[model samples]
Target: MSGQLYLGLDLGGTKIAAGVVSGSGKLFSLVRVATPAHGVRSDLRALFDAAQATLAAARIGWPKVKAVGVGVPGAVDPRTETVWAPNLPGWKSVPLRRLLERALGRPVFIEADRNVQAMAEAWLGAGKGASDLIFLTVGTGIGAGIISSGRVVSGSRRVGGAAGWIAVTDRWQPAFARLGSLEAQAAGPTMVRAARLALRTQKRGVLARLARADRKLTGETLVRAARQGDARARRILAEAGEHLGRGVASMVALLNPELVIIGGGLAEAGDWLLAPLRRAAKKWGQPLASRQVRIMRTRLGADIGVLGAARCAMLEMEREKKSNVDFPSNQAG
Candidate 1:
């Protein structure tokens, strides 16, 4: 509290997590709350509540927080400070930065969640030593953050890092057209749907039994079942892994990243996902780039997103200090 303290908020689809982090990448207090499904209003309330709770838990005050950084699951226009989050209904063109500035009484920085995750990894996590890397999150949805020559790549529209739409297959399906080709085939929900479809034809596996018992299937359920020697579950994961690998291969060929760090919920499957992903990447990826790239799971675990947000805050604070610009407090939205 005496020195510079940064507030990091990860506004995920299902949960909003906030953490107070020091300038040296030390996390102080972390808090999480379920994301309200109602709309953007509820989501904003949940985010504010989580941030306030985290600050209180850390024994800090609003004035002490040098800057606040938020990572949202969607496109963010840093220039206009607007957000277009598909998962958050009614979030199209929302002025997230201005609203957070008013609510938190501090300057706020917003970026795509995956980009922040890549920043966190490059700064203090698995991709620490790598100057060029990609952080891919394969969970409820699929996305990628690209870093080249030690810089985050924000394309012309500031949406270049969104790799979920990367085409992994030539065949065009409705889901692919709507949700992005790679995400349509490899995201967590897609995996579950694939498993359900597979069970219809081949009903001989622990997956079928588990689906019958639970009455619903999830990526976690499929991963757990796969670990228990469920053939269908393993097959589904393998297929997803292959699709994911193809996507990674495309990224590598284009970006030539030194490392690729995979995170998010589905990553809990560990080697079950990595092994096949590695195989497919090597098979489909540009040989030179794929051979040079090192693919690994995230070392930061659940804290990656928040930590990434913290990194963004720290960077923003540094920029402000260098430019000698006083960050406005309680700005009007």
Candidate 2:
């Protein structure tokens, strides 16, 4: 549908966020609801409700809504309009486009969540002017969305930026098959595990003290402990950062992006995590590439995925229009 506002659905494991976005990258009428763990059927209901509430929040109706775009949490095949969203659980080769188009009565575009994040950042966030950039998210698991020459680098199989699979060590474990070496070693859960392990051997660390009665070590605990001048916690994060940097170095050498933007739950560690990452990237990256590229944290905050999904829909619409104009169906052969 051709309309003024675009509907962006950011589907995540825990929540579904719907936002009405203007063409100029202004987001409005954001509505959030819990994602249904039951199944895709229930999740679709939540998605539908979120969309309707978002439009009402912005005081807009469906007639004013443009095409819808969704950012899924796993592999996406734009051509087939199918998604394999692992985070959604039990979603395998789901025909998301057909379902959404039927439910919302609007054209739908789908992309991996990481790719959607890059789209938003490039459109209106940190990578505003850069033609080539890497958007890396280091949360539940590490993933990247790479853009080169103003185009997305979706691989032949649409898994081009699967950064979680980056190998940082020579030792290969079967577990790496699922979580990848870098992720298994440095991702949020792994970081917490490392902190807990540190607490077992060294009882003097602030981290052990910060974990409440349950002694649950979380990323927040690590951050708080590090903030309170806990060397053990800081050291653990820095080590992870260094490992992440090694991965970044490989990306830098291969992609030679102008900017490497980092975002996600773990990124909240700020300079403590990033400082080491920068060092490792520089040290391991090709000298020329490392000298020119700048690594920084994402500035888009929490709404990155939704904004990106909307921007992605806008871009898809533009491309479709161009394709139609170039090969008019009305033209006689």
Candidate 3:
């Protein structure tokens, strides 16, 4: 193995984190920069600059880095190096890999952000010892990554595990007919919306105090109230958990994964979310299938994306090595 370091970039909607990770999984230099909210070009420029700064801070030039791996918040085409990001507008077919490679003068690999997170968990986080696992991030949005047979499972177009968009309801009307979506019901913003609607009613509980603390309700506030034993907050969380559980049930039936790792800002609700979700999964999902899957909170915290990206880079490097040495070479006389 080469004694070179790897650079990992986690380009999220809110922030871009870059770090130099040694082969032994030691992160030497780390830095974070706020992602530009203006548009696609601005965000991409900011991300590339941050990567350059991180490399400089580590005192390691692009020549010393074996590979540059990036995790994006949306789907990426490995063939075209295009990113289809919904949150980031005007990013369709962006030549991200080529752009980064041109700037850093190194091999650049790009993968779905959720896939990177799952890889991180599988390599060094909650799913380390587990062979089959599902990673769920429930925050501004809900998404998933599946690890089966000790490999990350990416469907065609690298958009395999979109758990958030899975339809839960049958009604398909455009306005009040958002029936088949876990994101529509249980994501962070959705939880706040539900809480706000609940507040309009006569239900009185800890949420009232929380709402008073911040006029605009958020998932953090809802979880805080639920933790304080507020009835309204608990009720709101319980309802959302039920919906989330149903989604988990669906996951169990389809994937039969050994473990489900839940993360993101909203997952901090702890048992308030897990308990109800478990009950709901039991009621909706296949009993035998759900029995095999263990749902737990992520232990990786905010570093999962970077770790996952590093893992991805390492994996790609390994593949390149194997292809170079193991494959038979053709020669002409």
RMSD of each: 4.2, 4.7, 5.3
lDDT for each of the candidates? 0.85, 0.83, 0.78
TM-score of 1: 0.91
- Candidate 3 local lDDT, residue 111: 84
Off by over 4 Å in 2: 1-3, 34-39, 199-210, 213-217, 324-333
lDDT for each residue of candidate 1 in 24-108, tens digit (9 for 90 to 100)? 7889999989888588889999999999999999998898988899989888875687999876678889999999999989989
CA shift at 100, candidate 1, in angstroms? 1.1
Comparing 1 and 2 on lDDT, the stronger one: 1
Q: How many angstroms is residue 292 displaced in model 1 relative to the true structure, after the best TM-score fit?
A: 1.6
Candidates by TM-score, descending order: 1, 2, 3
Residues 248-318, model 2: lDDT tens digits: 99999999999999987688889999999999999998999999999999998768878888888887787
TM-score of each: 0.91, 0.88, 0.85
